[model samples]
Target: MAIDDSLATGQRSLGDPAHDYPLWPPLTSGCPRTSTEDVSYPVEVDYAYDKADPAALFSPVRARGGLERWAPLLPPLPAPGLGEGATPLVEIEPGVYVKDESRNPTWSHKDRLNRCTTSAAVGVGAPGIAVASSGNHGASAAAYAARAGLPCVVFTGPDTPPAVDAFLNAYGAVVLPVPWEARWPLLRLVVERLGLHPVSNLTTTHTGHAYGPEGYKTVAYEIFQDVGVPSAVFVPTGYGELLFGVWKGFEELRRLGLADRVPRVFACESAASGALHRAFAEGAPAAHVTVGASEAYSIASPVSGYRGVLAVRASGGRALLVDDRQLADAQGELARAGLWTELSAAAGLAGLRSLGGQAPEDGPVVCVSTSSGFKDKGMGTHRTAPATPTWEEVERRLRAAGIAG
Candidate 1:
């Protein structure tokens, strides 16, 4: 399928919109004018919203071919795709739904971001792609890079999940397991010395690729299409790209006069490293915290980004932190509801449950489940002992388990 031409005008700094730059060579280092030693800001793509036609862009009969359908509102998409968008919105309770993103090509929401980031790499005519990730991001980047026929280098922590490690190898990516703090620096070296395009964050505070989150905005568009504008959206936030993207998508709807208002967006983070939460509490644009032990490895981010702060603040929402216990409980709840998600992906539901009686009463609320349970650490380590083949033993075991035949 032929990808549609992008209507993206240019790029603008999230910290200072007055400082604009060309669409090519995305400001990966962020706005040089507004970024500082303490905190760094990310850049966002500017689309020709006034020129967009609601009837054509939001047509119910639009063919489904991933992010390409929304090309006019997205950055240049030169790279090929694996059908990344069009996830399902499953209702788990009355007026409460879960945006199941694990159905994507890589079984994670990062597929949406990588599809755009990889396209940026292709658009810029870079040699290859490099990234620093814990699991999902690396796997998604590797898949996209391979699809684009570009060499990929993945810098991951020594504790990288087995499933993700296998994914990197399967995609023919050069995998380097280093110390947690060394990933970003190594990624920078790969970009500078090797001339490979970086699809991950390279800054001190996490201003990821300019085109990455633009891919994520499709999540909101799909949600809006499935079930009008939700009252609120809870997202599993690490660097806050997904949260900001979802909020921006809805904001665009309202801006285009399609929707009356934008939903309140919430950031759900692991309490072990509540960088966004601390940033909000301290009234800072971004902040860094010493990360503690947490089972929700995917969302246990140590730093907050300006994009997330902007999304929450502009939407009049708050950043909420959930402990590992709450995350596990949420995971169990989802599994019982027939949706097995990564522990970190459950943070959205965990955050909402944290609200208890204070949950939103206006309209339907959505909790975005970012990845599948298969992406979790130590996913297949446990081995269940085989039961005895004898009928007596099976009957006894079944009876003990309340499954008598």
Candidate 2:
């Protein structure tokens, strides 16, 4: 098949693609969150999705405030609406703000990761993109692949939600529902044999794509621009890419003289799988542990990332373990604040609440809410008693639920 010329490539290129998406100048510093080794590299930029010729996310106008100001015209972001970045840093409570990332293209922070990583595929001339995820990551991958006009293949656990399945199908993705155990091998086969760019964490370890985190850095950029540096950032923990990306983004800003100090980042995870926590506590680079204590199952990974550990240590950050009860409370609290987020998404808020007011009170604090309640689907759907009532009865129920009659 004569694939489209806009595919991402295997080699790291400073070269432009069929469409020249803007990019920052070459990185001059080592990993912002790690002194151990390289985080990842040769990330690509897919087609820019901004409705205008240059989106404000990557525009010098916006960058003047963030590190993007340092590399004005740094590759323009392909942020095509649906609230890609620059999410409102709302101060729902005194001294605390939510950098609600549930507003992204796929309704989660994963969109940022794919935006940068999938661009790598187009930059290197890869024909398609592949991901192994049961949730937000797969949806985000499909969205980006569709935007770039490249084929997308998703390998996810069979338990993947119906909404997620429908989304992939709607986006023209080749969805392959497989057993969780087989995801890794399948991802490798697809990328190696099919020449597809992978936006997944492979290696049955912390080995992740360099490009994915590039997109994620935009969160830190937005936070710095909107709220300045907080004492800490609490990230919903998973493969640790998001945690590291936020840390790196701030560190880069400081390096470029964009900001003053890096925040003490926190990886908020469900107590079920405390791989990252266990690793940090064990004084090991990484660790593997099985867990089953929370519905924040989206982040229940057995593997701990050496890079994740490095991030926590370098930033003087901490990892906090949360439970399902705490996550449910956080989700409820967010609803009260008019932000409906998924269990995994609310995990950050849960971690913060768990920490009480112990976090430094001087600077602005932001919690990245990663996904939406719809992504969880389980919460949005209910088998409640049928509302098959007369009009008056229905009105009574509506009023009871606080809906205006």
Which prediction has the highest TM-score against the true structure? 1
Across 160-263, the per-residue lDDT of candidate 2 in tens digits comes to 87887888888899999998889989888887798888878665457566556666777887787676778899899987888877887787667655577899
Task: Write down the RMSD of candidate 2 (Cα, Å).
Answer: 7.6
Candidate 2, superposed: residue stretches over 4 Å from native = 1-83, 357-359, 377-380, 383-405
- Write one digit per residue (lDDT tens) for candidate 1, span 1-405: 343478888899999999999998877888889999887889999987888988788877636648888888999888999988888899998889999999999999999999999998998899999999999999999999999999999999999988889989999999999999898888899999989999888888879899999999999999998888999999999999999999999999999888999999999999999999999999999999999999899988889899999999999988999999999999999999999999999999999999881346688999999999999896999897788899998898889888995
Clash pairs (backbone) in predicted model 1: none
Off by over 4 Å in 1: 1-4, 357-359
C-alpha lDDT score of every prediction, in listed order: 0.91, 0.70
Could you estimate the TM-score for every candidate?
0.97, 0.79
**Weakest 10 consecutive residues, lDDT, candidate 2?**
64-73
Model 2 has how many clashing residue pairs?
21
